[model samples]
Target: MSLPFLILYFYLMNFIYNILVHIAYGIIHFLSLFNQKLQLFIKGRKETFKKLSVIQSTDKTIWIHTASLGEFEQGRPIIESLKNTYPTHKIIVTFFSPSGYEIRKNYALADVICYLPFDTKKNMQNFVRAIQPELAIIVKYEFWPNLLSQLKKEGIKTILVSGIFREKQLFFKPYGKWMRSFLTAFDHLFVQNENSKKLLNTINYNNVTVSGDTRFDRVYEILQQDNTLDFINEFKYNTYTVVAGSTWKEGEELLVNYINEHASENEKFIIAPHTINSKKINELRNSILKKTILYSERNQVDLKEYQVFIIDTIGLLTKVYSYANAAYVGGGLLTGLHNILEPATFGIPVVFGGNNYTKFQEANDLIRLKGSKAITNQHEFNSIFTTLKQDVNVRTTMGKTCGDYVKNNTGATQLILNYINNLFQ
Candidate 1:
C-alpha cells in the first residue's frame, strides 16, 4: 500500500524473474547438446502463439499440464475419461520437461502436446491468451507462481488433480509465506490422501477433495491389454520367478548379493534396471557370477541355461511384471522411488526400500494388506524373499492381498471426471 513497500516488492519480483530467466537459459543449452531435435522442438514453444495461429480452431480448449512422463501416465486415465464423456471438447496438453513431452507427443487423445514455455510473465500471458481454455487441470506437484497468478488474474477455472502434499514441503513451512500464495490460485484440488488435505487446510486453502490416485486406473488398464512377450515367454517357463522391475544400482546390488549367497535351484531372477546404458548393463553383468543375458543383444532367450535374465531396455518393465511370481520395484533403495502400482496390478507381491513408504499410497496399502514388504538391508531382503519363495501358500495369499489392494483403489479417475463435469454443468 505504501510507496516504499510497493517499490521494494517490485524490485524483489524482478530479481526473482531474472534468476528464473537465467535458469531457463541454462536448461535450453543443456537440452540442445544431447539432441538437436529437442532444441528445435522447444525453440518453437518459446513463441507458441505464433505457431498456433495457423491451426484455425475457433472452439474453446481444455488445457492440462504435467511436469514429466510419470505425471502424464497418471493423467492418461483422465484423458480417456474426457474422450468418452466430453467427445466434442478440444483438449491441449503441455509438459515442463523433455522426458514428459518426448514420450507422449504422439498421444491420440490430446489435440496438441508441447513443452510449456518458461514461466516468465510474458510467456504465461501469451499462452493463456492464445489457448483461452474453458478449464485447466494441473497434475501432481508442479507449480509455477507466475503462471498460477496469471491464470487467477484471467479467472480461469483451474484445478489440481491427483494432488499430494507433505509436511516438509515449503507450502507447510512457517517461513514459506510467499510460496503459500501459489496454493490459493487453484479453484479446487483433488488430493490423493488425508495428509494432503490436512496440509492444505493448514494453509487455509480448503477447496480440496480426497480422490485417490489415477495411476492405479492406468496400471489396471495395462493388464487388460495383450501382455505376452514372445522372448519373455520362453524365458519364464514353469519356474519360480523373481522380477526386479525399475531397479537402480543399490537394488541390483542387494538382489545380486542375495541370489549369489542363497543359490536356489528352483528360482530364477529377472532385472529391469532404471538406466539401461551400455556401461551400466556391463557393470551389472560383471557384478553377477552367473551367466547373464542382455535383452538388447539377443532375440530368443532360454530360461533354463541362464538363471538370470537382465532386461537392458525400457518400456518393457511393466509388461514383464505380468509373468512375474514376485517383484521388487526399485528407486527407494537409492533416492527416488519407482512405480509400485505397475507390479501390483499383476497380483504379484512387491518389495522395495524402506525410505519410500512416505509418498507412495499404494505401497502403504499393500503393506497394510500384508502383500508387500519394505526392507532396509540384505538380511531383511533375504528373509522376506526366502519366506515368500519356499512357501507357495504364503506367496498365493500375499499375491491375493496385493491384488485386493489394487482393486480397492480403482475409482479416482471416475471421481475426478465427476468433479470436472459438475463444474461444466
Candidate 2:
C-alpha cells in the first residue's frame, strides 16, 4: 500500500471507531436509568473529572491505567516501587471501572486516583494535556486507541505491563490491522509468558519482554506481611480447616452439600462469599445444614459451637487463607475464576470449579504441578476434597508445589522497574 493511501485508510478507520465509541456511550447512559451498577458507573466518572481538575499539573507525573480492581492489584507493586524510587514524581492511577476506583480511591501510594475519561479524541487530548505525564503504564488488556494515539502525539513513553496476548485475540486476526496499529503505539510490552511474546512476534511486534506476572510478586509480599487473624485462629484451634475464598452460588452449593454429607467433626469450613450483602449472607446460611456463624456475629456467639463459619465482611479473605489446610477459590463455576495465587502463596492446595481457565495461566500451571484442582460438579469436588482432607502427605506435597510456583515467579516488578529506570536515563 502507498503511504498516502495508508494514511487515508487509518483516518477513515479511526473515524468509524470514534462513532462506535460514542454509540456505546449513549447505550450505557440509556441503561443507567434502569441499572444501579450503570448508574454508579456514570456517577463515578462525573466525580472523577471533578477530582482531576484539582490535581496541579507536574512534569514528573507517572500515570498508570487499569480496567478494574483485578488489574489494579496486578499493577500495584510497580506503582509502590516507582513511588519509592522516584519520590519527587507524582503518581496518578486511573481506572476504567467504578469497582476499581471505588475500592482504591484512597490508595495512599497514588497522589490521585480517578476514573479514566471516555476514549473520545477530545477527551483523550484534554486528559493528556491536563496530566502531562512523563510516562504512562497500562495494565493487562485495556487498549484505548484514542488515548494511545494522544500519548504518542505528545511523545510520552508508554508501556503495557503484565500483558498476555493470545492467537485468537483481535490483534492477530486478518481484519485487525487497525488494532495492530495500536500495539505499535506502545513503546514496549512486558508480557506474562513466552506464549504472549511469540504471538506478538507473529504480528511483527518486537518491543516485548517475558517479564512474567506481577501478581505473584504482590502475593508473595502479602505472605511476608502481618497476616494474623486472632478470631480465625480461635475457630480453627486444632482442626483441619478448608478456607473457601470468594465463592459464588454454584461453589457455595457444592461446598455446603459436601460438608453436610461428608465433613467430619474434626474438620471446619470457612466460606467467604463474593458479596456480603445481608440477603446473600442469609441465603448462604440457610443453604448450609451445618451450624454456621457469621464473621460479624463471631463475638456474640461461641466460636467453638459452629462447624462452619461464614465470612460476611470485606478485606479479610487473603489474610484468612493463612489459616487454611486447603483452599477453594471461587468464581470458576460461574463467569471466571478468582485469584488462585493468594492461597498458593500461603502454601495451600487450591480447588475451584472448572469453568474458565484460559485467561488464568496460574491455575493451569498449578493443576499441572498437582497443587490445584478444577472440578465441574459436586461429585468431582467431593473426590478431590476427600483426598486432600484424608491424606496428610499428599496435601503437604501439593502445598509445597503451590508455594514453589509462587517463589519461582517473583521479580517481574524489578524487571519493570529496571526498564523504567533505563527509559529515564
Candidate 3:
C-alpha cells in the first residue's frame, strides 16, 4: 500500500475505534440510571479529572495504570519499589475500573489515585497534557489504543509489566491488524512467561522480556508480613482447618454440603464469600447445617463452639489463609478464579472449581505441580477434600509443592525495576 493510503487507513481505523468507545460510554451512562455501581463509575471519573486538575506539573511523575484491584496488586510491589528507589519522582496510579479506584483511592504510595479518562483522542490528549508523565507503566493486559498512541506521539516512554499474551488473543487474528498496531506503542513489554514472549516474537515484536508474574512476588511478601489474627487462632485451636477464600454461590454450596455430610469433630471450615452483602451472608449462613459463626458476630460468641466460620468482611482473606491446612479459592465455578497464590504462598494444598482458568497460567502450573486441584462437582470436591484431610503425607507434599511454585516464580518485580532504572540512567 502507498504511504498516503496506509496513513488514511490508520486514521479511519482510529476514527471507528473512537466512535465505538463513545457508543459504549453512552450505553454505560444509560445503565448508570439504574445500577448503583455504574453510578459510582460515572461519578468517580468526574471526580478523577477534578482531582487531576490540581496535581502540580513541575513534579517528575511515574504513571501506573491498572484495569482493576487484581491488576493493582500485580503492580503494587513495583510501585513501592520505584517510590523507595526514586524518592523524588511522584507516583500516580490510575484505574480503568471503578472497583479498583474506589478501593485503592486512599492508597498511601500513590501521590494521586484516580480513574483513567475515557479512551477518546481528546480525553487522552487532555489527560496526557495534565499529567505529563515521564514514564507510564500499564499493568497486565489493559491496552487502551488511544492513550498509548497519544503517549507514543508525545514521546512519553511506556512499558507493560506482567503482560501475558495467548495464541488465541485478538492481536494474533487476521482482523486484529489494527489492534496489533497498538503493540508498537510500547517501548518495552515485560511479559509473564516465555510463551507470551514467543507469541510477541511471532508478530516480529522483539521489544519483549520474560519477567514472570509480579503477583508471585506480592504474595510472597504478604507471607513475610505479620499475619496474626487472634480470632482465627482461637477458632482453629489445633484443628485441621480449611480456609475457602472468595467463595461464590456454587463454591459455597459445594462446601456447605461437604461440611454437612463429612465434617469431623476435629475439622473446621472458614468461608470468606466474595461479597459481604447481608442477603448473601445470611443465605450462606442458613445453607450450612453445622454451627456457623459470622466473623462480625464471632466476638459475641465463643469461637471454639463453631465448626463453620463465615468471614463477613474484606481485606482479611490473605491473612486468614495463614491459618489453613488446606484452602479452596473460589470464583472458578462462576466467572473465573480468585487469587490461589495467596493460599499457595502459605504452602497449603489449594482447591477450586474447574471452569475458566486458562488466562491464569499459575492455576494450571499449580495443578501440574500437584499443589492445587480443580473439582468439577461435589463428588470431586469430596474426594479431594477427604484425601487432603486424611493423608498427612500427601497434604504436606502438596503444600511444599505450592510453596515451591511461589518461591520459584519470585524476582519478576526486581527484573522489571532493573530495566526501569536503566531507562532513567
Candidate 4:
C-alpha cells in the first residue's frame, strides 16, 4: 500500500477499534449493576480525571501503567529502582483493572495511584496532558491505541518492560498491520527473550532488547526476606510437604484425589486456592477425606495433626512456599496460570497444570530445563509428586535446577536500569 493509503487505512481501523472499545464500555456499565467486580471497575474510574488533575505540569513525574496486579508486580522492580535512583521525581502509577488499584491504591512509592480511565481519544488526550510525565513505562501486554498514540504525539518517552511477543499475536497476522503500527508508539521494547525480538523484527520493530523478566529479579530478592511462618514450621515439621499456590477448582480436585487415595503418611499438603469464599472453602474442605484444616482454624487445632492445610486467605502463599519440599503452583488446569516462579525461586521442584503454561516463557523454560513439572491428569500428577517424594537424589537435582534457574535469570532490572540511565542524563 502507498503511504497515504496506509495512513487512511489505519485511521479507518482505529475508528473501528474505538467503536469496539465504546461497546465494551457500554456492556461493562450495564453489567456493573449486577456484578460486584464490574461495579468496582466502574466506580474506580469515575474519579480518574478528577484524581489526575492533582498532578502538576512542572512535577518531574514518571508514569507507570499496568493492566492488573500481575503486571504491577512485573513493573515493581523498575518503579522501586527509579524511586531510589531519582528520589526527587514523582512516580504516578496507574492500573486499568480494579484488582491492581484496589490492592495498591495507597502504594507509598507512587505519588498517585489510581485507575486509568477507559481508552477513548479525549480521555487519553486529557489524561496525558494533565500528567505530562517525563517518561512512561507500560508493563506487559497493554496496547491501548489512543493512549499510546497520544503519548507519542506529545513526544513522551514510552517503553514496554517484561514484554513477551509471539508469532501468533495479531501483530503478525496479514490483517494485523494496523495493530503492527501500534508497536511504533513505543520508544524501546524490552522483551523476555530473543524470540520476542525476532517476532518484532518481522514487523520492523528493531528498537528491541531481550531483557528477561523483572519478576525473576523480584523472586530472587525473596531469598533475602524473612520467609518464616511459625505455624507452618509446626505443621510442616520434618515431613515432606507439597505446597500448592493459586489452585483453581480443577487443580484442586486433582490434588484432592491424590491426597485421599495415593498420599503417604509422611507427606503433608498445603493448598491455597485462587478463590477464597465460604462456599468454595467448605467445598474444598469437605472433599478431602484426610484430616484437613482451614487457615482460619489454625489457632484452634493441633497444626501437625492435620494432613491437609487449606489457606483460605491471601498474602501468605509466597511465604508458605518456603515450607515446601515439592511445590504445585496452580492455574494451569485452565488458562490463567498463576506464578510458578515463586516456588521455583525457593529451590523447590515446581509442578503445575500442563496444557496452558506454554504461553508463559518462564514456564516453558523451566519445563525444558527440568526445573518444573507440568501434569494434565491425576496419573501424571501422582507419578511426578510420588517420584519427587520417594527419590531423594531426583528431588535434590530438580530443586537445584529450579533454584539455579531463578538465580541465573536475575538482573533484568539492572539491564533495564542501564538503558534508562542514559534517558535521565
Candidate 5:
C-alpha cells in the first residue's frame, strides 16, 4: 500500500462511482417513460432543490435520510422523539425510493419531506449548502460518497441507525479501501447486532454501538396503539384466522395451495399481497377456490360470508395482524421477508416461505426459538398449518415466544436518542 498506489486507487474508484451514478440516473430517466414508479422517482427529484429552498430552518435542522419505506420505519421513532425533544429544531426527511416518499410525503412530523437528488458531487454540495444540517441521520444501508464527504467537510455530525454490516459487503472486501475511507466520516454508527459491531471493529471503526434495530421499537409501539380494526374482528368472528401479509407470487402459491386443499370452514384467511396491482390481485384471487372477498369490496359485502380475504391495497395489513391466530408472512420466497415483527407483536405464531431468510437475524432466531416456522414447499407448509389449527397449546406457546422476541428487541430507539442528546449537551 504505497502512497502513490493508494492515491491512484482513490482516483479510480471515484471515477468509477461518478460514471455509475450518472449511468443510473440515465437509466432511470429512460425507464421513467415506461414505468410509473420510475416516473415518480424522476418527478419527485425534480423538486428536491425547490423543496430545500422552501425549508424554513436552514441551520436549525436535523436531516434524516432513508432508502425506502422499511428504512423509514427504522427512522420514525427517532423522528417522533426528536420532534418532541427539541420542539423548535426542524426535521428534513429525505427518501431515495418513491415507495417511501409517495406514501409519507405529507407526514406532519417532518417540516420537509422530499426525494433526495441523485448523489452527484454538485447535487450533494448544493443540498448540503441548502439544508446546512446540524446533524445527519441515515437509516440503514445508504452510502453516498459525495453527500457523506460533503457533510464531513462541513463539520456536520452524521450517524447511521439500525445498520447491519456483513462481511460479504463491499466495505469488508479486499478492494474496499476506497469505499472504507468514507466510514471515517461517521461520528458514530448504531448497528442492529453485536456481529455488525464486530465487523465495524475489524475495520477499526470502534465508534459503533450494538443498539439493535429501531424497527423493534417501532413494532413495540404498535402494541400501545389501538390495533383494533372492526373489519378484522368481523372477518375473524371467532374463527381461526391466518393472515398472510406481503405475499409475493411464490409465497401466494404455497398459501393458495394450502387454503384450497387443507382449509376447513372454521379457518379464515386474509391475504395482503406484496404487489396489489389489479392484475396481481386478480391472479391471487382466481387461484383460490374458497369464497374470497377483496378489501375493495369490504364496504359492499358481508364480511363473514367470505372464507378468504384479499387485502388488495396498502396501509391495512398492520392492523389486520391483531386478529390473526397464526400469521403467514410473505417475501421470504422471492423478495426477502416482510415484517414478521408486526404479527409477532400481536402474539401470533408466524409462518413464512423459508428459502431465502438465512440473512435475516430475527427470522433465523425465531425459527431456532420455535416462535416461527419456515416452510420450504407444500408439504412443510401443510405440516405446520395443520399443527397450528389442531394444537392450542403449541399455538399459544409459539405465539408467546414471538411476542417475547419483539418485546426483548426494543430500546434501540432510546439508545440512539440518548446519544443524540449527549452530543448536543
Candidate 6:
C-alpha cells in the first residue's frame, strides 16, 4: 500500500475503535439506571469519594485494579495476603468496568472501590497525582497504556497477576507496537501459562513469570468451606442432580431441548443463568415442559418436586453446585465461559456450549481430560448429557478427573502472595 493510503487506513481504524468503546460506555451508563445492582455500579465513582478522602490522608497506599467481578475474586487472595503482610499500607482498589466495582464496593479490605476513568493522558496524570500509590497491581488482562506509562513515570512498581495471552490477540499482531508498550510497563507479568510467557517474550517483554490462574485457588477455597445448602439438599434428596451454572439463552435452549427429549423422570436439574433478567427467567420457564421453580419465587418445598430449578439470584452458584452430580457451565455460546472451576472443584463433570474460551485454562484442560464436554447445539447436548446420565462408571470416573484437575491447579494464589511478600521483604 502507498504511504497516504496506509495513513488513512490507520486513522479510520483508530476512529472506529474509539467510537465503539464510547458507545458501549454510554449504553452501560444508561442501562445502570433501571437495575438496582446496576445503579450501584453507576454510582460507584461517587461512593468512592469518602474512601478516597481516607486514602489521601494515609501515608502509604497500594493500588490494585481489576476489570470485573471475576478479576476481583481472582485477586482476592492476593489482596488478603497484602493486608496480612503489610497491615500499614492502605489498599486502593479500582475497576475499569462497573461490574467489578459494583460487586465489590463494600469490600472491607479495600479502602476505595472506584471506577477508573477512561485511560486518557489527563485522567492518568490526575489519578496518579492523587492516589500516589507506593505499589500497583493489576489483575488479569487489564493494561491501560496511559495509566501504565504514568505509573512507571511515578516510579510505582506495577505487577500483573493471573494474566493470559493468546496467539490471535492484538499484542501478537505485526502492527501492535503501540499496544505492546502497555505490556512493557509491567515490572512483572505473572501469567497463567508458558504460552502467555512465550508470547510476551516474542514482543521483547522479558519481565514475566508463569504463576498459573488464581481462580483455581479461589474455587478450591470455596470447596473447603462448609458445603451446606438446605434448599438444594431437599431438592437433591440423594438423587443424581445436574447443576447448570451461568447459562446463556442459547445454552439454556439447548438444555431445555435435551431435558425434554431425554432427561429421566428421576433425575433433577439446577440452572443458574449468567444474567437473571425477568424476561429470560420467564422465557426459560416457558420453554421447559417439566415442573420448574424460579429460585427467587419458590420456597424450599416448591423446588423439591420440580425436575428443574432456575436460579434467579447471584452469589449462590458456588454453593448450589455442591449438591450436583454433574454441571453444565454457561457462557460458551454468545457471551463467554462462566466459572467451570466452581463445579470442577466439587468433582462434578461439566458441560457447555463452545466458542470464545481460549482464556479458560480449566475448561480446556478438563476437555482434554474427558471430564468436560462442549456442545455446539441441541443434538450434541443430548448425546453428551444422555451418555453421562445413563453410564454410572463414566460419570464417576469423570468426576474424579474433575476433582484431580482442580487439586493440581491449587497454589497460584499462594505463588502470587509469596511474590508480593518478597517485594516488601
lDDT of 6 by residue, 1-425 (tens): 68798778766765665577668657877998787776665576555445566655456889888888888888888888788888888888888666566557789997667887666566678788778987798999877766887998888878999998999988889887557756767889899999999998988888888989988888888877998988887777788888898888888888898788788888889998887689878988999998888887676455677898889887798899898888998888778887788898988788877775656887788889998888887788888788888899989999999999988988888877777777877
Q: How far is candidate 6 from the true structure (C-alpha RMSD, Å)?
A: 3.7
Which prediction has more favorable TM-score, 4 or 6? Answer: 4
lDDT of 6: 0.81
Compose the digit string of candidate 2's lDDT tens values, residues 1-425: 89998899999999999999999999999999998778878888787667667667544799999998889999999999999999988899999987677778899999889889889999999899888888999999888999999999998899999999888889999988889998877999999999999999998999999999999999999988999898988888878999999888888899999999999988999999886789989988998888899998999977977899999987799899999999999998887898899999989899988887757889889988889999999999999999999999989999999999999999999999999999988
lDDT of 1 by residue, 1-425 (tens): 68798678656865786588879768876988787656855674765565455334477678899887789989989988897788877788888876567668778998778788777778789788778888999998788887888899899999999998889888888767667877777989999999899988988888999998989899988879999887777776688899998788888889999888885877888899876678888988898887678887555545457778989866788789998999998888667677888888888888899875567777777787789899889999999999889988888888888877778888999998898899889
Q: Which pairs clash in the backbone of model 1? A: none
Q: Which regions of candidate 1 fall more than 4 Å away from where they truly are?
A: 1-24, 27-57, 300-304
Instruction: Between candidates 1 and 3, name the one with more favorable lDDT.
Output: 3
- Superposed by TM-score, candidate 4 places the C-alpha of residue 402 at a distance from the truth, in angstroms, of 0.4
Question: Candidate 6, after superposition: displacement of residue 179 in Å?
Answer: 1.7
Clashing pairs in 2: none
How much lDDT does each candidate structure score?
0.82, 0.90, 0.91, 0.90, 0.91, 0.81
Model 3 weakest lDDT span, ten residues long: 48-57
The TM-score values for the models, in the order shown, are: 0.89, 0.97, 0.97, 0.97, 0.97, 0.89
Residue 362 of model 4: what lDDT? 84
Cand. 5 Cα-lDDT: 0.91
Q: After the best TM-score superposition of candidate 2, give how far the Cα of residue 392 lies from its true spot, in angstroms.
A: 0.8
Candidate 4 — what's its lDDT? 0.90
Off by over 4 Å in 4: none
C-alpha lDDT (0 to 100) for residue 84 of candidate 2:
93
What shift in Å separates residue 273 of candidate 2 from its native position after superposition?
1.5
